[model samples]
Structures are given as structure tokens and as C-alpha cells.
Target: MAGDEDMKEGGLDWAAAYRRLDRLAAATDAAATTDPEQEREVMDERARRLARTVSARATPGHLLELVHFHAGEQDYALETRFVREVLRSSEQRVTLPGAPEQLRGVVLLHGEVLAVVELSPLFGRPAPTHHGPVLVVGQGRAELGLRADRVEEVLSVSRDALLPPPPALGAQERTLVAGLTREGIIVLEGEALLRDGRLFFDLSEERVS
Candidate 1:
């Protein structure tokens, strides 16, 4: 039930906490010193060490590596293997007139016209008007530029910490969601997402308005 503030208040810094028993050993070495102040210091240090040890051991372990970013109001992540590169989405993109609304347009990247997909709609959220950056995902012809509201940081997630999508999610959003992270990040099934959407196939042949 304790929060981060509680841990900080108790001096539960990991490194210091893990070294709790070490101070006990040090106290033994200084056993010959009869100075009351020195003895009191050692006892206080021992208490701090005990607190840290309890805190560290109680913390659960759940870690997975992912490239995280923001889209709409939610946070999302893709495994590093599926990430090709990340570029600014502010650069003008050539809009595909007849493509699905999810397909924002195509952006030129490294001399290649990369099809950009707006994930907000696919996740059942309203499309964001302001673009942040292009998260280049997948590889080869399956590569895509995903429009992110903001690119956060690469995270290490714990498999056990992932939660199932809420039952209230629409089928489309559920299909794209791998699971919800303990920290609330949406872990996406990158390969399944791209395969299911098939964003690039027949993109050159725009639909007639």
C-alpha cells in the first residue's frame, strides 16, 4: 500500500537499501570504539539498512523492453525488433485522397515514399490534429510510418505486469492491443497490427472520389 513518497521518506533508495546488512558488518569492525556517538551512528545506520532491505525485497520484478510513444490520450509501445526508425511527422505528407482515414498519407523518408498510418482511429480514438513524429515500423515492403502524438522513451516492461484490454474496448481496439502495461502503456502486437491492416497494398491506386 506504500507509495513512492513513502519509500523515499523511509530512505529506500535501492543501492542503499540493498547494502543494509553491510553496515551491520561494519559495526562489528568498529566494535572496539567505545565512543557513544560512534555507536549511535552505527545503530541509526543499521535501522536505515533494515528499512531498505525490506523495501527492496518487497518490490516485484516485471520488465520488458519496448520503444514507447504517445498517440491520442494513450501511451503505446512496440518491441524494438519491429521498429525501423523514428522521424518528425511535422514534415508535410502527401495525402492519399481515397485511402482510409486511418492512412494519414505518405511521407518521403530516405528517398522512399513511406505510407503513414494514423493509429488513433484504429485504436478507436478520435484523430489528433497535431502530428508529433513518425514512428517507422516493420521492415521491407511492410514498413510503415505511424503518426505519434509524441515519442516518449524506450521502456523495459514486465510480462506479468501486462493486463488484458478492458471489456469495454471495441473489437478493433482490442485486436490492436496486446495488453495494458502496469504503468498504463498499451503494448501493441506490432506484427499482427500491420498484417491485419494491410496498409500498403494497392495504395498506389487511389480510390475514386
Candidate 2:
């Protein structure tokens, strides 16, 4: 059929993928299983399926993968390539003296102190006294965690779909945002974020001395 041919031109059999997702959904037990681990796995699978759906909406070769997340009351996204991992925030966070106000604290990540950034103030909101999960991102020495109130899921969008930041955003806010999607996700400029010197602190000095 023409639909199959259309999907072929895009390089993905999106229809087949959607049908398989439907089967998975139908097989899920409505009763809700008691196993936390199993439930987490199921949710993750659903997220993956949703990402595929978004990718299908975008043109095949032009798709840009993003990790969609919630920060404060707003929605945001970062290119998947910059994000190394998502870590659960810990209450044991240690604050360092003389760091920028945006620096929330440091979290123990894989036997190292990973600096955490709080962007709420940049958007005219009061900083959260308690940090949320950390989005591990950046390049080399700049790699650190960006606090998020909640991580929704990973997604994909067409390059053409990213529209310019709306006029409602303040000057500072405009500088941080690369584009906004129809879904209301403000896509931050990953390279600009990585190059921001404020995000980096010489942690190597604190390392074995």
C-alpha cells in the first residue's frame, strides 16, 4: 500500500512499530502488578515506544533525539548526545562555599563529586531548596548534573519543528533556549550549555592531593 511505501521512504516501518506497541499495550495487565522492578521496566518500555512515535512524526533522517524533562513548572529538552546519564538526587548533597548561586550542591556520582546546577533563578523562579534528579551532561571537565523536578522521558523531533523562542521569554531565558517545540518543550542549546564556564568548577584540585 502507499502507506508502506511512504514509511519505506522515511527509512522506518512506523506502522509496524505502532502495531507492535499496540500488542504490548493490549497484553499489559490492568490489575497492576505488585513488583516495583517489573513495573519500572514496563514504564520504561512504554517510554521507548512513545519516543518511537515522536520520531515517526518527524522526518526519518532529520530526527533529533532529546531527553524531555520537567524543571520547576516548565518543560525542557536537551539533545541526547550531551546527556551521559540521569541520576537520582540525594539528600546527602554537600554545598561548597564561594560557588555561584546557581550551583545547588555536589552529589556523589560513581565515587566522585558531581556538581549540580539549579536553573530556576535564571527563569525568574526561586531556587529549589532541595534538588531533584541530576541530568549528567557536558564535555570532559564541564560534565555535571542539571537538576530537574522530574524526568518525563526521551523523545525525538524534526529539526524543522524547533521554532524560535517566543517573545514572552526574558533576554536571559532567550539566550538559553535554542528553540521551542509545538509540544511546549524549550530545547536548550547543548553546545552553549557545555561551553558555559559557570557550569564548571576545578574539581580536579579537590581530587587526590
Candidate 3:
């Protein structure tokens, strides 16, 4: 939070990126063609374009755009580049058997099974009364829906504003933190959170026993 005093209300830049994503997403889902081959080709091109657009969104000028939210009583944020969307509800969340405590459950999203991660155990905080918004993040198998209490707003802050996490936090908890704001909001490194082996479980039949 060192340089966070300059944090201006964000709506234009981040919202515009989301608008572009919405248009591209609608285009893919609404692609219509009499020929199946033509439709495939069109979809492929749009996907490639979207990939490029996504890569271009990486912190420009060391200015990080973050999606701020609450999980229980703690405040947290993740870089906007990794956030795909926010779902108000995790409908039909199917609880898994014999899974790690942090592996909350799974939900069918966009025709794929997305794992819903329980953030409490990860942060060493107690579980919330119930799940709230789901922040859809990451790519393919590594993707997850982070259960949250409420989403605040997107804000742009310079990377320099982040301070190293307090020394007393455990190694596991410290690994996920990119930095902490002076006000105590934990800004997490998106890729580190996704790559955590604990979040992705291989629930084979035997493993589920």
C-alpha cells in the first residue's frame, strides 16, 4: 500500500477489457455457418485472437489491475489477467469424497467440471457459513472457481506498492502471497495459486475411497 495512495477509482480500463472479452465470447458461442468446417475455422481464429489479447493484458508498466474481494473476514485480490469471470452462484456444486479439505467440490461450468476451491484452509482461516461468488480463474485443467463472500471492485495499483508479507506467516501461506498492502489486503500471485498441487486432485475411484 506504499504507492496505493494514488489508487484511482477503476472502471474504464478494466471494464473495457471485460467488454472486449464479452464480445469475443459471444462471437464464439454464436458462430453460425451452414458448413461445419467453416465454423470450426472461424472459431479457431477467434480463439487465437483471444489468446493474443489475453497475453497482451499482462501488467503493463508494472501497473497491476486486480479483482478485489472478500473471503470470510479477510480481504484478498488476484491479478485481473488470471480472472476469467465471476459467477454469482455455484449451482449444483458436487462435493467430492476423500478429497483434501481445501478441495471444496466441483461444478459443471461451460461443459467442463471446474473444481471449486475452499480458501479458508489455505489461509488458515475458518470456513465461512456458506459459499458465495465464484471467481473463475486459470486455464484448462488448472482452472478453478474460488469461493468468495463478496466481490468489491477492480483497482489498478503499481507493483511497487506491495510490501513483503509478514514474517510470521507459515511457508505454505507465504508462498501464495505476491505482496501485502499496508492496509493488509493480501495480493496473491495468480499462477502460484493455480499451480498449487493441493488445489488440483486426481480423484480416481480408488483415491476417492
Candidate 4:
């Protein structure tokens, strides 16, 4: 009986030792599988590849800064390279149906019938009576005119100066506005302004007539 009890105790000790050995083996395997040096190598290779791709895609071009005017306020900036032309307000004239309410009329800019949109009413403000210059932005196949109260001087701003737009801007402004800068937010929706046919001049034909 004494011998049997000793054997049973020994058996338990062996079983416990085996369990400890198994746990240690599992820990060693996990450590090997998650080697930090291997992970670092993979991350380094991925970063190098990404940097190469970005460097290859980069191109050189002339950068231009444009001041976007709206209502009585000067709100945003645009890249002048994107601007097709600038016209006098008197040169643009209002036309009949097929134009949007926000669209004052179509202007013949560069031999293209460009829709001229009033910026004030689109921003929920009254259209200013102020005579200013019209900026003709080239769209896909056509161009759109944005009538501003005035055309400020073209500035040469660095790309770093351009920042993201403010969170406080409303939905319409958000859609139209791009990022902000020390000057103000930049407008990136010149294409959107032209494509959105719903924007028409506030004046009716009868009223103008």
C-alpha cells in the first residue's frame, strides 16, 4: 500500500511537470512566430516601396493662387492654373429660359457658352448689386462663370499654406469649399458649380424684362 501511494504521488508530479513543459514550449513557439525583427523588416520594406511610388508619381508644374470673391465677402482661394479666363461683368449678359435661377445667363467665353452663376444666392444671401469681374472656370466640356464683387490680386501662395476647410461651414459651403488657409478656405468645386444645373439666377425673365 505504501509503495502504491508513492507511485500515485510520483505520477501526479510527472503529469504536472509535463503540463509545465508544454506551456513553456507553447510560449517559445509564440515568441518565435512574432519575432520583432522580422516585423520591422516587413514594415521597412513596405515603407520604402511606398516612398518610391510617391516619388515616381510626383510632377512639376507652375502653381498659381486665385482669390475667390462672393457676396460682399471674399471667402476662398483657387489655383489660377485651373482658371480659364477672367471677363468684365459688363461683358456678360443675361439670357432667357434653359438657364438656372442662380445662373444670371450664359456668356460666350472663349467661344463657349458658359453659364454665369451668382454666388450670393447660392450661399443663401442676397445678390450684391456690386459690379465686379467674372471668373470663367473651365468644366469638362463647358465653362461656368462666377460673378464676384471684385477680383483681388493674384497671389503666389505655397502649397503648404493651403489647409483643410473649417468644420463650421454649412452643407452647401462644405460641398463647394475645399481646404482653408491663412487667407481663407479654398474652393475646389468649380466643376461642381458648373455641373449643378439647379443653380440659376434669382431674377425672373419678367422682372428683368
Worst 10 residues of 3 by lDDT: 1-10
lDDT of 3 by residue, 1-209 (tens): 01222122431122232233344445545655346787888568757745743663565358888889999799998887787777776544554433467766666555555677877788778777576888888853338889899999887878899999879789988989989877788998887898898777653223311
lDDT of 1 by residue, 68-98 (tens): 9989898898876567656654544544333
Residue 107, candidate 1: Cα error in Å is 0.9
Clashes in model 3: which pairs? Answer: none
- Across residues 7-85, which tens digit of lDDT does each residue of candidate 2 receive? 3332443344334333434444432355667878857865774475444332224677888999878899987766766
Arranged by lDDT, best first? 3, 2, 1, 4
**Global fold similarity of model 2 (TM-score):** 0.62
Task: Provide the clash count, candidate 2.
Answer: 0
Model 1 scores what on Cα lDDT?
Answer: 0.64
TM-score of each: 0.62, 0.62, 0.68, 0.53
Clashes of each: 4, 0, 0, 8
Compared to the true structure, candidate 1 yields what TM-score?
A: 0.62
Q: What range of 10 consecutive residues in model 2 has the weakest lDDT sum?
A: 1-10
Name model 3 segments beyond 4 Å from true.
1-56, 97-99, 139-142, 203-209
Q: lDDT per prediction?
A: 0.64, 0.67, 0.69, 0.52
Q: Which one is best on lDDT?
A: 3
**Candidate 3 C-alpha error for residue 66, in Å:** 0.2
* Candidate 4 wrongly placed segments (more than 4 Å): 1-64, 67-71, 89-92, 95-101, 110-112, 140-142, 200-209
